[model samples]
Target: MSAAHVPVLLAEVVDALQPRAGETIVDGTFGAGGYSRALLAAGSSIIAFDRDPGAAQFAQGLPADRFRLLERRFSELDAVTGPGAVDGVVLDIGVSSMQLDQAERGFSFMRDGPLDMRMAADGPTAADLVNAAEPAEIARILYVYGEERESRRIARAIARRREEQPFTRTLELAEFIEKTLGGRRGAKVHPATRSFQAIRIAVNEELAELEAGLVAAESALKVGGRLCVVTFHSLEDRIVKTFLAVRAGKTPGGSRHAPPVETTAAPSFQLSFNGARTASAAELAANPRARSAKLRAAVRADAPVWRAAA
Candidate 1:
């Protein structure tokens, strides 16, 4: 494992999936192949997916007979694997450590690089978003995605500045955001952190992709197959939590004050355990990034995959 890209909750995720010989597992986010490599060690065949072209560099040296890497998004997993094909699916949501460490990737504000934050090789970059989006849209992106409190103020400042010069560099925007927010006021985190996160999420459509990927996992896993997800923030966690809760038949019944959520389809998944698992104290001591990480796992039920009504 790369010291810089330590897989979060590896032991817990491996325990949840319990890979066995001849079983096929899908590594939904093969950033540095940490999960895939661990699962492969357990004697399972690995089918890993990553949209980032740079991720292919890490796939080298792995046994070609046991491991296969796909240069595609995990949301397309079911389309590639077909229904109920895999034994397990594991997703590590949000940007990868490798992406952050590469200055040219433009995922970290601390790094001075071009303002391109696309996870894949192509797309409208984060620079395009901030420089061209309307002030209201930019504020909405910051407030909704980043949960930044001073989103409107920041958006206004960005609007005023972009009129004179477009943001092309990561540090240029980071420093501007810091100055606009009055030099962080002794805050532990930088003022640009939230804004950068919001912009990246917006540029990548991360939340939507997560929702679609979860549904894809449901379709891809066989009965009794495992699905494990590691989410870094509340936005991602909430989606996974709700998806499992509803799919596990844990939704609330009708009440006098509120109507019941329509239960039209059979539950397709069962929670592996109640609630999510956090990293152990030892794990947290080694990796501060694990502080915000939450691991949720479930087992596929012997039922049909749920489809939303048109």
Candidate 2:
């Protein structure tokens, strides 16, 4: 299948990965097959995974001999392949541009459609959460996931409105939110942006999936194998940063009140770059969606995957 959206930080990810001939790489979030296509062209075999079943249609025309698409979440990577089997793994976190553009997906508040925002076909949709979740739970989701400031007020508004009539359409909910939040008041973005994002993330459990998927990648990569992650927002980026920092043994430990505690654990990975890389001005100008993109990469160490301290 052809790419419906351009992959952000493509060259940077490729440079970090350096996929070689005969090596196997995992495209853990194979939206539109952009990275998979590029890696395939570089002569590497790929095992690509995507939670969205709709993404499989885009898997067409790929090299069948070198490519295999798994219609499952990337969190299943370690389960699907034995430890240290793949040379590299890459995850592009958050909703894709194509998903956002498709009104039927309910990822965007710009267009009117059903309030379904599931990555995979089978799941409780955004509509289910908004209509059924408790107000406090809804507030927590908005606050924690979307970082929305007026989450409580928004949740209350939704609770009251859904009592009158359950939200079934995207624009219907978006307009109600706009009215509750004072009609955007000439804001740069739509009033329902945060609500949409929060609902979508909650529906898909995206943040949890990302955390699991990163650990899975750590387990799946062979020694010296690389991991490249492209995150669109701070929530996803923060998880990636913390995971790598702790795994690389770069995180500062011990409190000012206590002496340093030592551990025998070995570093699982080494940072490939000093910090996350952002999109180039040229690329951002060409594709506005690439503006929020950030890329971070690392090389795996020979040490076994670290488990949480008991």
TM-score, per-candidate, Cα-based: 0.96, 0.95
* 210: Cα error in model 1, Å: 0.3
Candidates in order have lDDT scores of 0.93, 0.89
TM-score of 1: 0.96
Clashing residue pair totals per candidate (backbone < 3 A): 0, 2
- Residue-wise C-alpha lDDT for candidate 2, range 184-288, written one tens digit per residue: 677999888888899999999999899889989988999999999999988888778877877888774634422344456789999998889988888878878
* RMSD to truth, every model: 2.6, 3.0
Clashing pairs in 2: 1-59, 1-60
Output the number of the lDDT-best candidate: 1
Per-residue C-alpha lDDT of model 1 across residues 26-116, encoded as one tens digit per residue: 9999999999889999999999999999889888889899999998989999999999999999999999877898899888999999999
